[model samples]
Target chain A: MNRVSAIDIRNVTKAYGPTLVLDDISLKAEANEFIAFLGPSGCGKSTLLRMIAGLETLDAGEIHIGGRRIDEREPGARGVAMVFQHYALYPHMTIRDNMGFGLKNIRMNKAEIDRRVAEAARILEIEPFLDKKPGQLSGGQKQRVAIGRAIVKNPDIFLFDEPLSNLDAALRMRTRLELAQLRRRLNATMILVTHDQVEAMTLADRIVVMHDKKIQQVGAPMDIYARPANRFVASFVGSPPMNFLPVSVSEGANGAVATLGDGSKVTTRVKGLTDSASWELGLRPEHVRVSDQGLAAKVEFVERLGERTLVYARLGDGTALTAEDEGLSRVKMGDTIYLKVDGDAAHLFDADGKGYHTPEVG
Target chain B: MMSPKARREFGNFLFVAPYLCVFLWLLIWPLISGMGLSLFKADLFGGASFVGFENYSRLLQDPVFLQAVGNTFYFVALTVPALAIIPLFLALMLNRATRTAAFFRGVFFSSSVLSVTIVTLIWRMVLMSDGGFVANIIGFFGFDPIPFLSDPNLVMISMSIITVWWCLGLPMMLYLSALQQVPQDIYEAAALDNTPWWKQLTHITLPAISRTVVLVVIMQCVLQFQLFGQPQLITQGGPNGASRPIVLFIFEVGFRRWDIGYAAAASQILFAIILMVTLAQYFVASRREGRGR
Candidate 1:
């Protein structure tokens, strides 16, 4: 894994006829970095990747890879390879030919092309089925062939557009592990576009969370999880989603003090002086506790997952929130439960869904 | 007294009985009678005698019949490729033409609906020996009018071209349908692979639509091999029977000369050729399916 080339995208914009699909988007992926664009459908994630691949023309902005501008170059001239979402392997060619097609097109010596293709097949463990056409192979095998095609080219950047979304779950996990291995082995920049947060969280060095035609946030996985930039990221990045509850804030010993709906007070470690504006507390289910000395809430339902129990509760003001107890806890539906939030672990978001977190310690 | 299942089966048989009767009368019966007729030295209006293989033996040495067979092969060779390829190019060109594509597809295909007489009549005006449109155009280029239909060598080529133009619509439409089914990402992938346009076509476009190509090629083979109406109406199998195809020779022998036995034998040969083409298509298609599995 020796090659390292950074990709920088600046002020990129795109539109489809009259609709603005992407607006003023920009990001930089450093050398050997695996970055993911995480968003829901129609977030222009795939479109942005395609624009870099030269499939979709950029309405405005410049893209540079390894410090050379590539936005206007023909797709073939760009030193990048893309694996399409559907694994668009040529139906007519055998797996070997499919992997070696680009080399043959360049008129590379036959021996060299064969060696590269063989090396790729061996790496991907697809050597046994090299002679079979795509139609003769299963979904997973074809997916490997598609990856092998990209690997044989040895591009400086590899772009994947939801490459695993089509596979069944077990195969998807295995393929995902292989992709992580590929990143370490290639030592090249990789940009993956997917709506699946788990894929983004597990494999990426940094995640670019996109929503509503704009980037929401970009940071390391756990950083974003622990200190999400906004309510959207807080809610989008986690399963069983983060819960938001209205609270009144004021000056406190270490940070802001937030008053719960049932008139219960919790002191946060955030240092502030004024109680000026309305705020909401953002709490992941794990950060909320069920304590007898805290706010009294009635549990509406309980999910007894084997690892943990999720309690959906409502406060006296009828504001719904989710809290957790031990997996073996005896919390029942319709029970009156006292809930306490960890102020240091909670977040403060303004009316506009902008969030603020307590300062981190060294 | 019948079981319900048996009664339902009876109803199903009754529903198909009409088509079965017509099939036997129009198709199956004619084939059997034709085979029986080929074994006899028969006339259209007179008594017949059993000739057994006599007519078949004579056909092997008949110069006109042999010429017809040779001429039919030449026509198929010329027309089948033109029909398969010209339509392909037209479809490919129209595929990207977008807004005007549908309009042009309709215009090109309009010729296919016209009766063969109307089509030949239009071509005859353009290709006639004297004062023809094509001849006048050639004269404008400071050359004498060429005898397109009168020359033995030129007539077959002329007829082949006319057939291609007249029949271009259907195969082009088929190719267009097949082309639309190909995912656009495939081509985008090729473009990123640095493949030239020609290589893309050869490697991707052609192979992807290969089943359709096989279909079009076999269809044109069957259609052009029965070359009758054009030469009959335009050239009248003239220029010393140079443009005489097998069906045309059969017509001349059976209907014009009252040699039913010889005509039936020639017809049998044609039927045999068509069967082979159809069988070839079957084998190719099944082998392709087998490869898929």
Candidate 2:
């Protein structure tokens, strides 16, 4: 047990011939911080994690662990341990051996290796299955063993590549909680790569959202939820993501006024926009209040979850928007309803997809 | 009178009938007949006579037959390890090779396509004691040409080397396919765990492909036990019968000396030895597999 080290990545770029997989990505993780790389599939978040682990070669960049340059070092020399998406536990080795294998290779004494493996197994609650091979364990048990393997290495940083993606929903949730607890217990620097935003939001101290080979935004989960950096982050980070409606802006006395696609105007607190610039009003489903007097929309479908109902509606100009209503609301399909936009909570995106936030009220 | 289900079952039987006929006629019948033949005295031009266990007992005391058995065991010891190990190493090297992997695989495998006779002929020319390719190279290096095929001491070694080269391809391909089947992420995980390359080979690669390794070892044992073609075509088991193999002895006793009964007896003993060895190998391999799981 040594002091956990920070990870610094600078100007890393990777490509497969003509197609760039990761483009000049730069990020840093403080010691003992848990960071999540959150994105859609093929977003190069996984590739960036692999580069930090030294599994994928960087075409151009430098990565430092504890402030030592590791770009040219062998993967074995890099003080990191990875838990693969598929577990990747050796099929032939028992759980004990799988956890101790890397230690054995490093020529650690037998007693020390055993002690570390036992501690890891106890931490992961996998002590009962230490003698069994990976094939005999449940999917969740195997994942725990995969994590235990990383733990026994006592690496400065732990890298997880969608470690819970294979489990069923219930098991995924349980394992995710266990992972969060493990992070607290170990207090090591950890990087998690996942496409599931909920996993990122729940497990990470900070979430780095990526798309199309570049980082879109990086912030605390609540910060990302409240003020997404761009249209892509807004759309990608939330479930049933933010809805967009084309609008035209004009300078108003208080802030700005946006004319919706249906030619209705709403006063918005969002500022620093040119009057002639085309903007889109970004509103989350929950932010659009189903009031009696607002923009006119006809409901197309209703998804009634236990607590809330999602009303999918189309505006007068055929622009689709979803609004969250009370579960007991009698808004049936084809019923006309008015969606009251909370201008303070809504976001404004220009044609280039850059988001403009409202100034905080004193 | 047949029901539809019964008729369908009979139709399924018909599908395998052709293969079954060939199998019984060519393989099973000969195997049974050979076992029966081992217990009696039969000559080429005389009536067969029952001589229970006589041929078997005589072979036990026959020095030439004993020598051939020892020679075959020696060849197996020499070639089987080489066949099992060299190809695996080559496969590991070729596994990581890109762009030229297919070409190298084809080149290495090309020698196996040649008939045993053709392979032996080529090696015989290369190994000739005078004015041969190997001899000339040694001579150029200021050393006298060593007899590869003629000397009694060097003949078996030369034959083992030739057989190993001729049959290296199949086992190499087996190892290659097994290596490919190992998931790539496991290696990546190992690398990230700081396991070095060689340790990764022993701890991960070899254990993952242990089943295939056992198969190649068992196959090489069976193949090298029957060593005949290399020694026969090149040295003709010459220079004091040093390179004579059990199968070659069987051929000589049955065909040249016209002692079919003795040859059959020897063949039965060789078969029993191979069966025992293969079964022992399987038992060890399966036991290891059980412990691993």
Candidate 3:
């Protein structure tokens, strides 16, 4: 934790055959920081994590850990431990042996290895199953052993590749919370790769959103959710992602006025873009409310959950839109409701799907 | 479920009818007949007389039969270890050969497909005295040409070599299959843990394949004890009967001498030895398994 940078990746690139999987990726992880690589499937997040683990070779850049170059080092020599997605526990060994295997290989004394293994088992709450083999343990217990194996290594950095993807939904939630707690307890630099947005949002100190093998934005989860760098980030970070609609703008006496497809004009303050022909408007479903003074719409369908409901409606030009409402509010399938748009919290995207500054606040 | 009292035992008999029929006709009946025949003295088509344990008594006193036992035991001792160890060595190499593993596995296993007679014929010529590959190679080293098939001192070794060459492939295939069952993740974990290759082999690979090794050793012992083809074709149990074996001697007694009772006794002895050795192997393997866990 005393090191300036626990992991410093510089201009790293990787290719698998003809496919360019990772391109010019660079990031510096601070000591004891918890970073999550969040992306959709096949976005090269796991590949980048593997590169840092020394499991995969870098085609073009340098990776340094604890201020030492480790590009050519083997996985064992890199001073990093990895927990694989499959929970790759040795089938033949008991839980005790599995946790102590790495220490034994490193030539730790018998008593020391026993102590470290015992300590890890206690931390993971797997002491009861120490004598049982991995095959005998349940899924959650096996995953705990996998974590214990890495924890016993006492490495500077821990690399996880979608480690929770195999668990059931409930177990995944509980295990993720435990992992967050474990990270805090150990104060070790940890990097996690996962496609689940909720996991990333809940677990990461700073989330790095990746798309098409490039990092789009890096920030706290709520910050990225509130202010995404691009359309992809805005779409990927939310559960029901931000909505987009094509709109036209013109200069009026007060400022710039935007007209929805339904001819409902809303005035907004924005800089530049004086010559653009058209723009796309983005807003989260939670940001917009069903108020009496906004654009009018007919609700096509209402999906009622226990806590919230999603009203799928259409604008005047038949453009589909959705809004969130309390589940207790009884709206039938065909009920018409007054829809409202909060112009300040809304976003404006240029032709290339990139979000920029919006002047007025809601 | 049916009541235990109403579910008659006839149902069990009906379920096992086919197996019982085949077992009696193929195995039990012949075994009983053989044992019965060994108790009486008879020629092929002549009337029999009770001889009690006379044939067995004579068998114990016969030097030739004793020699055959010694020779067969020597063959098993030489060939069983080779069969067990060499195939496993070759299998390990093939399993670890990342690039050409399939090709080398096929090559090593190719010999198992050949019939034993064909294999013996091939090696007989290869080990012949004058122009054989083995003799010529020895001559190239400025050493005397080994009388592989003719010399009493060398015939057992030569026959064992042929046995090993012919029988190695199957055990190698078994060990290879066992090796494939071992998870690659274990080895990767070991590598990441900085376990050396030799240590990994000793602690991981060896233990993982122990069952297969035990199976290979038992199978090799049984097969080698029944050694016949190489001695019959190459040396014809010659050079002071050094290459003679128990199965060949029984064949000589039953078919050549036409003394069915004595041959049956010899056959019983051979069967007894095979059974004892196989049981011993099972005991040893089960003991190891118990200890390993």
What's the CA error at residue A270 for candidate 2, in Å? 0.7
Off by over 4 Å in 2: A275-277, B1-12, B44-46
Q: Which runs in model 3 stand beyond 4 Å of their true positions?
A: A1-5, A248-279, A290-302, A313-318, A357-362, B1-20, B96-99, B290-293
Name model 1 segments beyond 4 Å from true: A251-253, A259-278, B1-21, B44-47, B281-293
Pull out the clashing pairs in model 3.
none
Q: How high is the lDDT of residue B113 in model 1?
A: 96
* A1-362 per-residue lDDT for model 3 (tens digits): 32224889999999998999999999888888889999999999998987777678999999999899988888789888888888878766788998898888888999999998998899999999999888788898999999999998888888888989999999999999999999888889899999999989999989999999899999989888877888899889897888887889776564556778877876655555546556877888987677665766778888888788888877778878888888786766676677777666777677777775465366
Best by TM-score: 2
Candidate 1: residue B108 Cα off by (Å): 2.7
In angstroms, how far off is A346's CA in candidate 2? 1.4
Error of 3 at A182 (Å): 1.1
lDDT of 3 at A176: 94
> Candidate 2's residue-wise lDDT over A4-74, tens digit each?
79999999999988999999999988999999999999999998988888888999989999999988888
DockQ: which is higher, 2 or 3? 2
Give per-residue lDDT, candidate 3, residue B117: 82
Worst 10 residues of 1 chain A by lDDT: A268-277
Better DockQ candidate (1, 2): 2
For candidate 3, give the docking quality class from DockQ.
acceptable
